[model samples]
Target: MAPTIPGFDYQRVQVADGIALNTAVGGSGSPIVLLHGFPQTHLMWRHVAAALAADHTVICPDLRGYGASDKPADPDGVSYAKRTMAADVVALARALGHERFALAGHDRGALVAMRAGLDHPAAITLLACLDVLPTLDMWQVLRGTSATVGFHLYLMAQPPGLPEQLIAAAPDAFFGHFLDIWSQRPEAITPDVRAAYLDACRAAVPSIVADYRASAGIDVAHDQADRDAGNQLRMPVTVLQQDWGALLGFDARALWSAWAPDLAHTTVNCGHFMAEEAPEQITAELRKLMAR
Candidate 1:
């Protein structure tokens, strides 16, 4: 059997016309959905989700193009946009009988949660994003040698064929590169979990690339539009991030404040994969976010 969140029940719920997300749900009161990040599945939340499941109905799903979820083709370059994936998440929650819920996401998944909070304010009671800046700010902050760290973003943002061809040529090396470097606690991801992450990412290369490509294209445009209109996340928002600002030379909290009016930003000491590296701290911060 595929690795799962031990006690949580799993199901595939249709979130769009022909697309359904593989979701794991547990616990009972006050729902809060957790979206997983790149090169990892909903299983990344196994530790955090289980803890939250004690008091909250925790919903963890592989985003539309990752893990066991549906990977739709990006024929129009908008299919894998964060807006589309965010809608998938909102739909998934409603399908499971939640009209409103707190939402949190990590890395790529955090991007989706941010979009959802902007587009569906009434449905999201509170929001938490882990270790990423908004798309607009992200593009703005990277300059000079600092931008080198995000080379994957540039690579996948290229026009279709080449990026896909290159990554697929040596799938493990490409995906594993992030898995290896992004974690401060290497032992946090065991061999079995590492294998699962690699297997899923290898099979979903095209869709995953399309997802990143949209961020460089349509996602940027969406963020730009929101900024132009003074759109902001209405709910109470919590942002947990590594000290990218210290190294990259930008105020992370100030940038996030532009998009989230009611914001509480915390700089974490852990690596990018803080959900796995510091679940206790993540859980505490999340509980605090929801209590707001």
Candidate 2:
């Protein structure tokens, strides 16, 4: 059986036609939806969600292509675009009886949250992105050797055929590589959790590739159009990142400022998986954001 968040009830929620998200809903106060990133599921929010559940209705959902969620085939990558994924999130929240809610996302889910904040601004009361920049800013910062660490981004961004085949052949190793490298506290992801992530990724290879491919193609276009139109996230936005901007020699705050006029950006000391490694800090920050 898949591991579950303690005290949380699991359900398969239909966010769109033929696309039902595997979701966990818990707690009782105002709603706050959390979106998980790549190589993992809503399970990544195990620690933080439990804490947030005390004072908020914490909703955790596996993004469309990951975990126990339905993985719709997207040959042209449109269905998996962050815009589409963001829509899934909005729809999920509404179905769960929340017309407006606080939103938080980690990694790829952060991309989805960012898009949602822009496209569905009225629906998201506040936005918190765990460890990512805007899609356009993310692509802009990828230059020279700094981009090497993000090799997987380029690898999976390729056309459907080969990337799917390659990842399918060694899904565990590929997925495990991120879990090993991206966490400051490797122990946070126990053996069971690691195995669950690998198993999910292994089963959803094609849709997973489509998710990344969309980031490279259609997602970027949506971001560019938003940027060109002078659109900004109107809601309060907070970003927590690993100081990659300082190491990569770009102003992280400056890049995020363009998109989030009312923004609070912080460079965290923990690794990319902040929620797991520093659950208390993440929970505190999230509560602070929601209160704002």
Candidate 3:
């Protein structure tokens, strides 16, 4: 079973766009929104959220498609764009009575958080991204051998139906591969936790595919436009990433610095799932960022 974090309560809140998002909220001070990555839910933040709850209101939400949130049918062209998803986070926080809040996201959530900071700078007081670069930078950096390391991206980026169908056929193996490979310490993800992740992915295939599909298309367009406009995150931005691209001969900090002008890029010794693999270190970085 996944290790339980004490004192956190789960609840659902209705946002303006007719979507009801299941959110796990705890603590009681300035609001800090925590967004989870792909194949996981608000539950991924369970350990780290409790630590933040002591001095801040930590709000963790399963981004629209991945967890207990309303999983709607994917529209023909535009539904799963990260920009649109970012808007959901914005409205959800406002509905929860936070006009201005700090934002943080991991993996897929990190993409949405990037959009939130870019599109709604006035609303986000601080921005923290865990283990990902901007989508455009990611695509630009993809090369021969380095690209192979992230084969899942290409698999998911395929033209719709194929990925969903194949993944649906063997959901456990499909999602479990990421859980096994991304973590340096596989023992951290107990069998039950793996099962829960597989279950979430099995139920969320179409939406998840739509998310990746959008990333390959519209999401790329949006990021490119931001680059063209010379836009950078105006708020204090912190990024933590493992050395995935270092082997590809790219400097992670230099690439990230190009996108986020007010940025503090650092290397964390954890694996891809930094929050889960090293919750204490993740929590410590979060505390330090909050202080700034």
lDDT of 3 by residue, 1-292 (tens): 4334468777788864667788888899999999999777777887899888999999888788887788777766577798888988999899889999999999999999999999999999999999987898888888887688878888889986888989999988888888878899887666766677777788899999889888888999999999899998999989999977667777888988887888888789877888888999999998888888
lDDT of 2 at 93: 97
Error of 2 at 98 (Å): 0.7
TM-score rank order: 1, 2, 3
**Which is the winner by lDDT between candidate 1 and candidate 3?**
1
Residue-level error in angstroms, candidate 1, position 150 = 0.5
TM-score to true structure, per model: 0.99, 0.98, 0.96
Deviation in Å, model 2, residue 27 alpha carbon: 0.2
lDDT of 2 by residue, 159-230 (tens): 878998988888888989999998889998888888899999999999888998888899999999998999
Which tens-of-lDDT digit does each residue in 86-135 have in candidate 1? 99999999999999999999999999999999999999999999999999
Off by over 4 Å in 1: none
Q: In model 2, which regions exceed 4 Å deviation?
A: none
Minimum summed lDDT over a 10-residue window in model 1 is located at 1-10
By TM-score, how accurate is candidate 3?
Answer: 0.96
Q: Clashing residue pairs, candidate 3?
A: none
